[model samples]
Target: MVEKESSRHPEVALSLPFTGLWLARNSPARRVPSHGTDLFGERYAIDFVGVDERRRTAGHRDWRTFLATEPADRFFAYGRPILAPADGTVVEVHDGEIDHAGRRSQLALVPYMLGQAARVRQGVRAVAGNYLVIALPGGAFVALVHLRAGSVRVSPGEVVTAGQHVAACGNSGNSTQPHLHMQVMETRDFSVARGVPMAFRHFRERPRGARQFHTREYGVPAEGAVVEPLPLPGAHSTS
Candidate 1:
């Protein structure tokens, strides 16, 4: 498949939402643009799924089980901590949506894909599920969606620092598996927001075949790449 052009567009400084090896999907450079709407602020959104060293979503799931279908818990990302991607004030928070089961089966995915329009019409809660919107410096509003149920730790008006534990990844809303869906917008209200460009700061990127990751600063990870966040210098304790 022809890849969508990787965006070299510079954006506000941000950080990867999770630690460890997370595989990027539907990235801005994927065959298609990362998301469906530029109207309600998701033009450059990206999806991330956790993976292990073997490049599998799970350490020991049968290949047949992975491709055919399984519960959301079967994936490697379920309940994993999703850190604050940037320091910001929480402008919006939505919770209480059921963390639905996963659907890796193409048979299930085809129907789910077809029902996307219906889900859209159901409104923000239907599409984003439980989520948080943070208003950062420089007028960027970041949305971290598809969060695990009962895992959100901040309130609408709370101030969050970068690297803080915020939520867990989950297969919520329209998500077929537990993953983090992150995007930056021009405004706080998603209904009228416009997607803004964004690149994570101080992360490590490993291309599909690379044995080691190289430090990346202010870089947007390519589609289908795996990445991890590096702690800021002196941020980790030796103990």
Candidate 2:
């Protein structure tokens, strides 16, 4: 069931949840009800798919790209470390779902899309797959979903700082490809939670097809923009 947003929801400040370049999809900067529904506290949710310098989702494509499902690991986002967006305590964690194969072919996606309702009916585990819910200081809860199977590192009640690694990206639950699905919510129980607005704190973004990048002090990246976190002060180089 979809929950309606209140007249006003304050925006929560967060850091980008992963390192390296990623393409933003279903961003609230593009539209409200970002994912096209208020179900599962996704009204302001955003998705990020890791991409290469040339912006390819995968290093290569083959018959599976057009006619069938591909291995989840074939996508650049698969297994990439998923970081904590803010200082918080792990309040919930689910790591039982299997990381499924990825789908890029419309033929493969067609049947998957038809199963969306069934997945929702199966509840949070079926739709969110392996996931983590972190409780922020002021009561908002941030959810990182579709995590790689067997990759969750923190247990419930564990405290975590911003930029700390929590899991890895994976193709699971309702996703078509390996990507991170993120959102903030009014409550810890997503089954009845309402969406909360959110913005990433410091990052660099290059719009799709653009030649240069721009720094964002604190805001949501536009849909299709490739984004990465600005290096933290004095951090050593690592790729």
Highest-scoring model, lDDT: 2
Question: Model 2, range 81-132, lDDT digits (tens) per residue?
Answer: 9999888999999997999998999999999999989999999999999999
Write candidate 1's Cα lDDT for 67-185 as tens digits: 66677888899999988887889999888999987777777688789998999899888989999999887667899999999999889888888888888999889898889998887
Tell me how many clashing residue pairs each candidate has. Answer: 0, 0
TM-score of 1: 0.88
Model 1 collision count: 0
Q: Flag clash pairs in model 2.
A: none
- Model 2 alpha-carbon miss at residue 209, Å: 2.8
What stretches of model 1 exceed 4 Å from their correct place?
1-10, 29-33, 60-69, 236-239
lDDT of 2: 0.90
Q: Report residue 2 deviation for candidate 2 (angstroms).
A: 25
lDDT of 1 at 177: 82
Estimate candidate 1's alpha-carbon lDDT, on a 0 to 1 scale.
0.80
